[model samples]
Target: MTDSTKYLQALEEFILLGKSAPGAAAVANIQKCISSPNCFVFAELLELPNVQALVNDAEHKKWVEALKLFAYGSYMDYKQQKSAASDSLPDLTDLQLTKLKQLSLITIASTEPHRLTYPSLQSLLDIPTTRLLEDLIISAVYASLLDAKLDTANQRVEVSSTAGRDVAPGDISNMIAALEGWSASCSSVLTEIEAQIASIQASAVAQRKEQLAYEKLVEEKRKTAEKDGSKGKRVMDHSDNTGFGLGEDEMDLDDGPFDDQGGARKSRKGGNKMFSRKR
Candidate 1:
């Protein structure tokens, strides 16, 4: 049967029990707890004003315990209570039984890790056989209470995920505190990463500047060397031209009639040339 239908039926049973006010209040509280995130019906049921009001009343005490068991208590809890006092325990209908099993599965998921063995589940569910336990788990999976894998070979159920339930009192505060801590940790990590990146970038910039300076220095040295080479070549050329001019002048003075005696030598040479022409 659908959960809503079962709930309505339970509500009607409560009304028939002559405790409509508290019964409806309890059921409403259960519904609210089931709908809220991370909330459990067990403690929430106990905390209900109506349920609490029934606690001291000898006549309605059974109904309060019944609501608690119906909303959250497991078959084991029921069994234990029945062992203690059978007459005090409320009889569970088939729908309520199914709901109890489903809620028990949710509790298991919340309290335990991913993988659960068949024997362990049997202990938790108080089921008679492995088949019944597997059937219950399968039903829960089909109802979308759990995302799981049934390993028949290994005799275990691997729960991959589960939905969140209503939050209990103080649960929100605890969650907020945990989230704040996580946020602080993330902020610290990000700060460290940013600092490291900044350091690397600065180092890279410094290295690039150093490389550019070195290149500029080499270029300047190259230009200076070229300038010095050109100057040396010009000086050597001038020296070679001066040596050649001096040698040519000495050769002309020694071979020709022109001596070191200034214009007299030049005039004597001209007269000799004229006499030779007349002869």
Candidate 2:
């Protein structure tokens, strides 16, 4: 069975039993249901016709109001009611008192996770010391009422989570406001994350464009260098051809047969002879 199945089943058992029971017997059923350690909610039992009849009874009407208190009111509320009209309210057993105190932790610690200070809870629950307060908090934790730890150094109860209680009268508006505030905070954080992602993408695109431009410039310079080198080689080849032709003509005259008078001469079979006189 589920964690709350047994508790609700026990409560439902009482409700069904009270339906057929007489007025006084129904009151007894309510008392037993509230006093059970497993049971917490009493709204259904409170609505029974037989149970409601006790409201008119002067002696037993207190049981109806007392069950309402256990269903919605905190332990502090119990104390206040008991103080005001001790004669009219039904007495709570040890289990009922302890359970109410645990349930009261949910109310006091609901607004903020870590807002309940040692003095505040102690005063509300009638706990005399921080040690006793811690024990109560531990008991509530063990019962799955709330997740909390004692902040001994700070003298506070730092609550992390709590079971949701039945929405008492006057709580709907506050709950809605709290939900709206949380939604707004989440939206703000999401926008910041999206902005950061956009910035990173833009930076990457700019870097890629810069890299491509640099590569294009380098390729152009390499092509220009190769063109200039080819043109210089052609000019060198032309100059070498012209100089070679001129050197050959000079060598023919100088290396030709020399006349007896020590003068230079160039002999050709098909053309006239050329001679150079000695200086």
Please provide, for model 1 over 1-279, each residue's C-alpha lDDT reduced to its tens digit, 9 standing for 90 to 100: 754454445444333433344755554544443343232234434554676787676765776676566455556687789889986865666666666777778767777754278888887777789888888888777766788888999988888876444454556798899999999999999999999999999999999999999999999999999999988873333245346423323322234454454332434223433112221
Each model's lDDT comes to 0.64, 0.79
Q: Give the TM-score comparing model 1 with the true structure, all chains together.
A: 0.58
TM-score of 2: 0.70
Query: In each prediction, how many residue pairs overlap at the backbone (N, C-alpha, C within less than 3 A)?
Result: 10, 0
Residues 23-78, model 2: lDDT tens digits: 78988898788778777677788888998899988988998888877777788878
Best by lDDT: 2
| lDDT for model 1 | 0.64
lDDT of 2 at 28: 83
